[model samples]
Target chain A: MDIKEFVAQSIGQWRSQRSAHHLAFGHFEAIRSEIAIEVVADHDPAVIELCKAHDIDPGSAVAPFRMRWEGQSDWDEEEEVKGTCILVPVPDPGQANRGKLLRDRGYAETMAAAGDYYLTADGTFVLTTAYDRAAAEEKIWFINPNVRCRVSLIKTSAGSGVVTASFSSEIRQEIRQEIRQAS
Target chain B: MDIKEFVAQSIGQWRSQRSAHHLAFGHFEAIRSEIAIEVVADHDPAVIELCKAHDIDPGSAVAPFRMRWEGQSDWDEEEEVKGTCILVPVPDPGQANRGKLLRDRGYAETMAAAGDYYLTADGTFVLTTAYDRAAAEEKIWFINPNVRCRVSLIKTSAGSGVVTASFSSEIRQEIRQEIRQAS
Candidate 1:
């Protein structure tokens, strides 16, 4: 599918179960989360504000997304971690599946991030982001229209030019309605 | 280039510089390393041993590799970190650029890893591995015959199914001779 259609299809509720691996510490964890993705109109106030914050032209953005995640991890049993982000995809003229992914909050909440997104010929969605001191790349693909899978790679470093830790995750996703109604 | 050509071309000493980004911890570090890749003959003792260890017939392995890495990082200043591993690629019958990657020492040395390797239509080399508690996927491609780049994603999980950390890295490589002579 083309980039536009792919983005449009992603507007829905998804429940995901992910298995994460911490390479440096030799540990693993199971995580479950629910994600809600909604499309924001180009002229919406939030989109406008995001564009202004990132110095992006509102007209150039093909799609703006508001994503919310609510989940609990094994490490923190009592609290459900929650986060929300606005993602804006700006135009990339010459490349297929290549564009800017602008986010309201990056690796750290205090910073904004502008990253790259690409859709491969085989329908794999790749997103890469670089922060002041951190960077990440995530790849997502659909096993079917209702089932999605993701792989993420994250790294952190100390000031003295050494990698302090590395982590990776494998996530499986299904439509929330299908999962709920089946049960 | 075809898979055979690609593998043959990779025989050389390489100097690499990598920037690792940690997502959850919000840090970045620079790492420098040198690698030497040599082809292991089909009848080599190491290849034979690896095939025996992995329970594969020696004749099925397309190529066996001996790779050594020597590097230093910020976390440890005085001592150099070093490792060596044997990578054996078994025949892939049905898919193009797809095969099994059998490694003597994976991620942390505690587990042996059997992974999949695929060469994309665009010539990107992709490797994916799953251990009992950790998983990783890495992509490598050559900008030209002499310049190569790689991106890696590693994840570790606990038995209870929670992901504690994620790590990602971007590495650039050049022929060791050129790098050394220029320096």
Candidate 2:
């Protein structure tokens, strides 16, 4: 399944299983414009209580890991991620027994209300791109929080699965340094 | 008309109207993917002469102005784009002209061939928004890259009218910069 599908099911299961609370974007529009959320004292209580409620360890639940690209890495093995890089903790999607915990705590109702919420491999929030340009032979897609991808899609047979994942052979250069770092 | 209608007509009259260069991207598949061009070098003489040959005055041509958002801005004006803002530039229909110019000069048939071919805004670039949360809604509906935008299409009791010509919104934020710059 594509990203949106993973959110509605997989993301929720992980959140509750880890006994963590998060502010869900749900199906909030993240296409062209933006809206911001701040993490402040107000957010601490919910997070702390959730941490305490769950017997699972919280320290190792999330951390930043750099993705190594193919070929010689531009970075030294311990280089501090050249340029700017963003690191945020993400609850693992592979959480154990997350579903039952949600049900027992009556969080199922809340989870159901939140259309769906999944994170990418690097904890990036995502949404599909929209809009097209015939003159440019281009299709545009969207990911949340300061990211938009304008790439080309190839029509190749991927066995028999009806999936549409695009690649940017002509990607003209540089996404966010943070994302580039993470990617 | 809206972006689609504007694009079709621009393609029809691009060369006739002296637009020496153009670029565009259409919905390539079921999944919306975008392929766009970026100028690796803006001062290439052969390419610039071709631009001039098409009556595409590099000075008045919509290139620099259109790509303003995609490149770095020096915070000349200190207005902040609140929240998790993401800027996605719509592929203007004018990309066709850029390709045609290259073809006329036999510089390159497709951007892939030239390696140096870049996207210069032929007309207006539109920015659409999908909110992740809520805030003031200010959207710029500019379109038609190869030529100038008369007025964006607006439906009213008096049939329809073009949107007023407004330059691209001037606010630039550091965190929400374009992944690619036209330079």
Candidate 3:
């Protein structure tokens, strides 16, 4: 599948259960979160700004979207995990399955980041991003239409040591809008 | 389950289908192989020698086994991928689910290597090894008694760049031995 189709299939609300291992600290943490992915208009301010920041033409953006997440982590029960990021995908003209993923908030860090992304033959989405202090590799695959799996690694800047590795299983929480007719 | 139990469950022949992406070259390769896992006796010479190489007591090794693989990669159809390796699992005395895994042949590099291994709450086995030129992260989990999944990453020594990332789906090829009484 191309990036647009992959993004379209992923548009929904999801209940995510994640387990993370901190190798440096030898700690295991559990997180439960709700994530929402919504499509963004190409002319949206966030999408336009993100494209400009990466020096990519706004017209080249395909299936731009915004993701918002809220969760609770066992590491610190008092602190809530919540954030949102705008993502814009620009497909390579030469390779249909490969492209750049521009993000307003990075996975390993909160800074703006652009990651290289590609789809495997089996339609698995793989993304890798390098940040100032760390790098992140993420893989996402669908087990079925409603269930998906994600694996992520946060490595040291040099990529020698992995500080954190995590696996998450997400189940889609489809929102069925109900219509009321005037009686 | 502990390391021993995990090893026991994995002792069998498997048909593995793997897809690997070499990020450096932006190439994708598919490999199909048959793998055999056989139990090794505690007194086996290879097990003893591997433990000694890692400076671990032979008696501490639990459920040692040898793995043999024969495969064909799409990248090189003429070159057959075939090899064998001895694996010795030495459980940590204090932690039941964590331990050291001594390997006769490393994943990223063909040299004797030791890796830290742990079983997650869901019984997924994760192993991380650091070799001279690269580091490897591997994760294996049983989807069912007859099916399993493996994910592996070979990264640069500094961990900044992922040279290769692979996903393998292994289906157990159970060997059923039959006994016939003398007629």
Candidate 4:
């Protein structure tokens, strides 16, 4: 499927199983969560706000999505946590598979971020983000229409150019409901 | 070139520049280092020791290589550090591009690790390791005979299945001698 088609199919409820690996400490943890993804109009208030937060023109945005995540991880087993984020995609005229991924609230940090994203020839969606002290590259691909997988790498810098912390993760995603249920 | 030939070509003194991103804290760091890689026979004493440490039969190993790294990162700028590791490749009967990667010292933790290694259809060498509390996946590919690039992800688990830390990195590699002489 094309890049736009792939993004369109991502709008739904999904169950995700994730395995996280810590590099410095040599540790592994598993996390199970659910996310609800909804498509929003380019001019939606949330989309507009996200663009404003990242200093991008709202008119330049092509597609916007709203995401809500709820789950329990190894670190937070007692409480179910929830988070909301807005993703705005700004096209790059120079490249078909490349664009800017603007986020109102970033994955690990709450600050807004503008990250680079591209779709591979094989249809894998890849994103790379650089924060003040951290950076991440994530790859997401569909095994089928109903199943998806993600692999990510994150690094935290200490002083000079040394890295004090790092982590790797693998995530599996499945549609929450089947065709019959949706119908 | 074939996988064996590729490994053979990796022997040399090379320089690497790495950028690390910390996911949770939103930090970024840079690292500069040099590595000297040498090929060792499968029956070498170091290879035998590595196999014994990991409970792998030495007879099954295909190639063994030694690596020495020296450099200064942002975290430790005062002193030049040196570290060494051994890499042993054991063939996987099931898959042509897949094999076992046995190491004397792992990337983050010091304990011996036997990671899964595979060559992608595009000729990228990928390695995935699982440790007691951490896990890592690394991808390395050559841009040419003297240039290469690497990407990696590491995750640290806190408890149960929760990940408390994560990092991602991108590295560029080049031949050391040619650049030095040019300068």
Candidate 5:
């Protein structure tokens, strides 16, 4: 517990509040790399062998990795696009200061809410925001991990009422998976 | 400013702190059927009539409506392959809320660094967190929107910064595109 008492007891301030609660919106350099290491420190086999320096399959990649080209058609211009997103998170010690204080007060009340929420991508943690990336990658390859969450939203559609969304859901923690890949 | 005093002084229960904020976390059948309104109204032409209910080209979907979603995925369980992201402001919005209270304690410290931050979409502000849909979308698009953050890496082999984690992050509204819908 040294590295300055684990950066004075929060390892780079809880890995920058769990990398600012998973890039708090989108594309913060694909997840990161200006070199700040110790991102929650996962199981620590040297942080899962330095997340293999960056293929990041913390078992089957999708715990706290994150990615998005934003389906580039000029994905709103982060230099027109190249590719980036790493964000590793595990070795929880104040879990990045409580995931950057619950996503900056839940993103300023959805920036005053009306018609903004609708992100898409899936291979884990449930999904279906739509545009149908092959039915959201076949529900991210049969995912269930006991109903934890990364993405799942409907938010008021109404033929019979719809408004869903999820994340860690206050520690019910079931999220199971088994995928293997190591060299 | 009527609707029950605009939900009493503009829906003042969201209590993360505010100076100019808005909200959305999901499971939003309009949050028990919309009532609160006015942390700054007029911006809600119903988010430009739901961007005219996605006719597309609202200048590239307004960068997914300004970005915010953190699903946290076990494949997202029944929520399913859920992923979403869009967080702008590497820096901006100032005076006194101190980067909106360090992005409101870094959005509950990125949902307690991805433990559980759920809702599953409704009127919108969707999340749940562990880091999948691109690290649950870097917990709001690469933090420090107030603070807490990760990723600095600078392209290595091709793996550079491998990513495929997703959960959820859907937020939009930073202004700048009103070219009357890019003309």
Candidate 6:
């Protein structure tokens, strides 16, 4: 699938179980989270603002979407982790499988970041983002329509060392209201 | 499961489909291979040689095994790709989930190499090896007893840039002789 189709297939509620290794601290953490991905209209205010922030034409964006997640980690049970981010994909005019991705919230850090994304021959999405304090590389692939897997790495700012590595398996959970409405 | 149990459960035959992205070359390759993993006794010559090469006592090694693979890649259909490697795991006395792995053939380069290995809390095997020209990081986890997935990255010698990234899905193919013997 291409970028647009990948984003389309990813719209839904998902339950993700993640296992992470913090190499720098020699610690391992497990987390369970609920994630929601939804498409945002091209003319949405958020989309326009994100485009402005990145100095891109909102009209050039394709398959813009937002992702939100809430979860608990074993490292800190009392603390609930959550965030929301808008993602805007701007495909390369010359290359069909590669493009730049604008993110309002970065993966390795909580900042606006732009990353390079490309799809492998098997349709796995590979993304690499560089932040102020660190760089991150992530790969996401679907095992089936309802199941997917993600692996991510958080590296040092210079990208010489990996501080954290994680693997997550996400299973789609159909929204009850949507099912009811469809029925 | 601990390292020993993981190795035990991995015995048998497997069919693997791999997709790799060579970043430096900007090329994608697909490979189909049949893998066979078999247990090697502590006294086996190959196991002993591998342990000796790493300056480790053969008696200290746990669950030494041999892996053999034969495959063809899309990039070169006529050039058959195959290799055999013997792996010896020397577990840390203090940590049950971490150890040093000695391999007769390295992943990124075909040279004897030693790597650090650890199992995440969820039983994902992670390994990092430093080679002469590149470094490699690999993670392997089982979705179930019959299926497993592996992701690997080959990076620059200093590990700043990823030169190649690959993901492989393997399905267990029980040998007919093994089934007959069990029955």
Q: Candidate 6 residues B88-180, lDDT tens each?
A: 999988778899999999888889999999887657788999999999988787655765668887767877555566666665765323323
Where is the poorest 10-residue window by lDDT in model 1 chain A?
A: A159-168
- Residue A121 lDDT, candidate 2, scale 0-100: 36
Stretches > 4 Å off in candidate 6: A1-183, B174-183
| lDDT scores in order | 0.63, 0.22, 0.78, 0.65, 0.22, 0.78
**What TM-score, computed on C-alpha atoms, does each candidate reach?**
0.54, 0.19, 0.53, 0.52, 0.19, 0.53
User: lDDT tens string, model 5, A1-183?
Assistant: 212222222212110001112122222211211112233433545435545654445553223322222112212334432233333332324332111100101121221111111223332222222221111111111122221122222322221111222222111111111111210
lDDT of 4 at A36: 80
CA error at residue A63 for candidate 3, angstroms: 0.5
- Please write out the lDDT profile of model 1 over residues B2-25, one tens digit for every residue: 556667877777765554443233
Candidate 3 global CA lDDT score: 0.78
How far does residue B77 in candidate 6 sit from its true spot (Å)? 0.9
- Winner of 4 and 5 under lDDT: 4
CA lDDT, candidate 6, residue B46: 89
Q: Count the backbone clashes (under 3 Å) in each candidate.
A: 32, 36, 7, 42, 148, 0
- Displacement of the residue A168 alpha carbon in candidate 2, Å: 16
Q: Measured against the native two-chain assembly using Cα atoms, what DockQ does each of the candidate structures obtain, in the order listed?
A: 0.07, 0.02, 0.03, 0.06, 0.03, 0.03
Clashes of 5: 148
Among these predicted structures, which one has the highest TM-score? 1
**Model 3, range A1-183, lDDT digits (tens) per residue?**
999889998999987766665533334566778999999998999998988888999998899999999999878999999999999989998777999999999877779999999887667788989999898878787655655668777766886445566666565764211101110
Compute the lDDT of residue A26 as modeled in candidate 3: 32
Error of 4 at B12 (Å): 1.6
Name the runs in model 2 displaced over 4 angstroms: A1-33, A40-43, A52-54, A58-183, B1-183
